[model samples]
Target: MTAQANTALAAEILEVPHAEAAAVTRDSRPLRLITCGSVDDGKSTLIGRLLWDTKAVKEDQAATLRRDSGSQNDLGLPDFALLLDGLQAEREQGITIDVAYRYFATDRRSFIVADTPGHEQYTRNMATGASTADLAILLVDARAGLLEQTRRHATIASLMGIKQFVLAVNKFDLVAYDRAVFDQISTDFKALALSLGVRQVTAIPMSALKGENVVYSARSVIPWYEGPTLVETLELATLRSGQSTGFRLPVQRVSRPGESFRGYQGTVAGGAVKPGDSVAILPSGQVANVKQIVTFDLVRNAAVAGDAITLVLDRQVDVARGDMIVSLDAQPQTGLAFDAQIVALQPDGIVPGKRYWLKAGSRRQRVQVEPVQQLDLKSGKWQSADMLQMNAIGKVHLSFDETAIFDPYELNRGTGAFILIDPDTNNTVAGGMITAKRTELGGLNAHEGRVILSLPADLAEQLLATELLASRRDEVETRRVTTSAARQLLDDIDG
Candidate 1:
């Protein structure tokens, strides 16, 4: 190649499409991750090692860590857990209590790590961290192999839609770098991950305290292991793609900066939006056209999921906070009854037929919950349950007093996820996801109510052909059952 060929190649590279280039850059954007495992599984030590080796912690912070380090571990390093377990109580108790977030970077990629508490009591905090994480690092003690808490953390992470998993078999040094033990643990964990429908799992043996196989390679120590280090797996891990199903902007607030300016402000939860796109105000079904997409910087022609902007509609409409602005062609399900899966976070648990404030996005409404079943973590079976105790993952029915808006959690997490707040204490008692809209009226089509007829089969056919019933057939459900079945159903009715 000549100088002219080189110049032409440079020009071609410079002419790469802005959108395509931006997308590639976005794909490589910092990955958000969470660390979770049983208590004393060395979650903090792993995160601290990552930060320390990656040079994320500043010198002043290191000095403070040394000053705070009452005693060093056998590895001649400061108590790495101290670097993350920031609370005074946690330091005293020698366990993490709250979620500790830290940022670090390498030349290949950047990372935001949420070091969640490993104790059973702080399972709620772990869920909070998993909600926004793209990957989960589940730590396990090499000597202990897999425990119940380890199973619980993995289950929660899986339920929250984290597909990527890294099983850090920590404290390998304590187990004398036993390859057989590592293989057994990894095999069992892979089985668990497979059961959870997580196909992407990378297991590595490491001694977090000794800084082996975390940011650095422990290849010499664990000669049998040839997998990438913790940091390596993270750097190559895929970021959660923009898997939104439809355009959704849960209105956080309606902005009326001046008489001429009226805008709906919120982060785009799913899909993309641009000027002139037809949108529907959810729960109301009111339609409007986008006139402009405004941001503090400038008027944007388009905005995709995760962009926070103000949308100015072409006409005035009744829009408010908690209402979702969505694409008209693709609308979310709106119904009074829905089925959900929840993790009971409170000590008193969730009671059947109890009314709680269901808050999703920015909207809150009264809802009655009836626990249907509780998931058995060990067996992976759903046992019939009327009440869910603390840390219990249960399925339940949520009947709203008014119309509830949602998408299935599998389709769009932002639109389909919610929390139940205790009306008496105003505390968020449970985090849940909309599984599906319940269609109780048993008919070929879903309808609001059921109408059973005890007439003769011939008479029932004749009734279906009548003009009044024919015209409104879709609006009502028709069910035909034996007199004995009807009597049993009537006996089981709550009234």
Candidate 2:
């Protein structure tokens, strides 16, 4: 496109009146989302476009950006990427180093978007953004298609429990708006999404540089594509909720004002609780009944997820800080050894047989980390590893001296996730998610010289037809899995 065409497109931006307060009628709480992909795939550019089109960028900042970026592009838009990449290191290197969080809203709803780094070395930083996101916007360059880094970002997002995805095929104008290229990339990514247990996805061709199909529709440019703009999809997406499991309240403290009153105080992490409900104090194996739900305002009858309240038990139990109070029937996993997937964050990678402080929810315990396998993000394979280097994703066995409590990350993200804090420096070394409790011996589950794989029926059939599997057909066993089973298989691959 010529500069004239670019100028015409730049004039279509719809600016919000103000940034501080959004008077738009909201249907729900602000949707927490993240934008991530391969390096130079327009992550920073896409977020800049989102903020620019929404008028979240202040006039003063915009002027500063134009000055700092040296000169405007052909489109007359200051290098939008400079609006993000705020760090001096990032600015010097022309890369995003840290997770830059920004807030913006439209007439329909509010949004909290985290623009994460796309480089392989910053994988840990990307995981930080994904940890709290409800949905993920994975951008792929139209000219480059899907890179290895794109798959890595998608894997991290899926493991972080992001169910919804919006595949932004960015730089479409650079590719001359080729329908075939967009369709091929979209198809490949959808397959990858399915392999990761993610199903809800929408693919749209866009040009972040031209401000097309970001907050504004690209219908005028690409008449064949008639999907909602990026913002529209996010506004209509579902928010993740942690209320699917049983009631869980990791006691933050015991509120004791006087001798007559005693209650366990904490935010409800999962499920619900009310008066007369049967609850159990985990790791101690003591049970009690909820006598009252006490809040600052009044004695409430019930409390659900996100609610902070003090619980008065009918009888005295050994409940204290770090002890979880949960429903009797639906309790989280409690054991001495558990299996988990971790991303090493610090420079001094996670060492095998080293003890670290594992904090999940309000519970903290000393656990030994044994590296079992490392993930090959390119091929989606798990390979044996003894230590995890920085930004490396791996599966490990966690062994605690006493009891540890957790839920599978797929079930409840709040109680299932943990961080490994180095005992020497008190620095966080890794972030992890519990996969399962171990009931067998040894740190790794193996099949000797043979390999076993749980895969989709079609993929499995293709493999069976290959020479490697076809020759050994008598040794293979196949079983049709339910939808839930298929997801579990995908979740088990690396994390």
Candidate 3:
């Protein structure tokens, strides 16, 4: 693409209402949340209520939902789940079969809620949603208390790095909104969550159908309950404050038009950027200076995390999509070998010696599964395994064909996560998180020698001729000895 077109694309992505620019920056850093539960546990209903009560739906859409209510036809509740259940089959089945993403904004924050399926068949889908989430909301039936599915969801969430959990005791109205029932469920879930290493657990008694304790506190029924409502607690929740520790922007596109302007465009994954900042382009180790920061309708002297802007460098540099722009001081390790935990979705197992495409950030590389260390779910202990089946969690060692920048998933979400794909089919097979890097023996100072050996053509010919002559001489000496023996025998006979 030309430089001008590239600059325009960047500007278009970054352009917003002046008031929205600041608001978007503050809220654009979304809180990824995943809802987990078993089928009929009201997972979909709770999500629908959260969106409806938050006033996220447009008036016309709400009117359509109201018009379409009262049928259990594929779409569960025509009013609430319709906002997220976009698929025809999902609407028909009245059950979520895959992960549904919904975006909404409140005065206090913006959220990307990942509504994951509850059935055992879609457990991998739930893991995919949970892997990138900061918090998890696990729904429990007030009548049933804690079920096996609840523990499984919580365990999966803990494994995926979700530290905060809210055990929402849903459908309290069925049990007459009893405080005793709510408290007992809360206590049971708390113990289970604690055992799973969940650091924070907040239990709330809610009735999604009744719209109680969801957006506003249900004053009449639960007068004794004084805790914050679901919306209020979410708004007050503390977010991680250390998101700006490293500089990382995966180049999405590169442009140079007639040599007038040349730069790269992508959303800032982390850290800050300013004029004269020294940045390195990954996989090539090329360095350049930030000459200017250009957006479509505005020019900025600096940009920070979440900003989408084109970076014009002082000198022409060879950069492209799949390359990372990083600060020199915080350059990530570049290599072919890395470690990751993969959650496989298909029934077809993931085996060693198989090649797959790995997409991490904006970089895509051809990767081979080197080995499967262990399956974490069945045994809860590490054991040797050959392949990962559906809904199976395993640690895999992967080797890439080219060098790529990466961070540990625990450290940086933007740089440390990736997806595995089948090269021939181009189907996404698994989602992975970089856990560690393979260390070479003898540290960084190890060395090996390189040399080549071959004989000259003339010398080779002469050696072959001399070997043939020696063989002929040996044959002649044997024949002469045989003739002498025969003559001696004849002389003895004549005597």
> Which is the better candidate, 1 or 2, if ranked by lDDT?
2
Q: Best TM-score goes to which candidate? A: 2
Compute the lDDT of residue 127 as modeled in candidate 1.
86
The list of candidate 3 runs beyond 4 A from truth reads 1-30, 58-68, 71-88, 91-93, 195-197, 238-244, 371-383, 442-495
TM-score for each model:
0.81, 0.85, 0.76
Q: Write the per-residue lDDT of candidate 1 for residues 1-495, one digit (tens) a residue.
A: 332342343344334433344455333478999999999999998898889899998999999988887666655687777779888899889898889999999877899999998887787789889988999999999999999989989988987878899999999999899777877887788888876768788788898888999988988887666566788677667766555577999999999879989999999988898899999998899999999999998999999988999999999899989899999998889999998889888988998899999999889999999998887876666788999998788889899899999988767888989999999998889999887788756643366345454566679889876533442343346678887887777777736
List lDDT for all candidates, in order: 0.84, 0.85, 0.75
Q: Which consecutive 10 residues in model 1 have the weakest lDDT in total?
A: 1-10
Candidate 2 structure quality by residue, lDDT tens digits, 391-419? 99898999999899998887788898999
Q: If ranked by TM-score, best first, what sequence of candidates would result? A: 2, 1, 3
lDDT of 3 by residue, 165-227 (tens): 878888887898887787778778777776555647767788877678888798789775665
RMSD of each: 11.5, 8.5, 21.7
Off by over 4 Å in 1: 1-28, 443-495
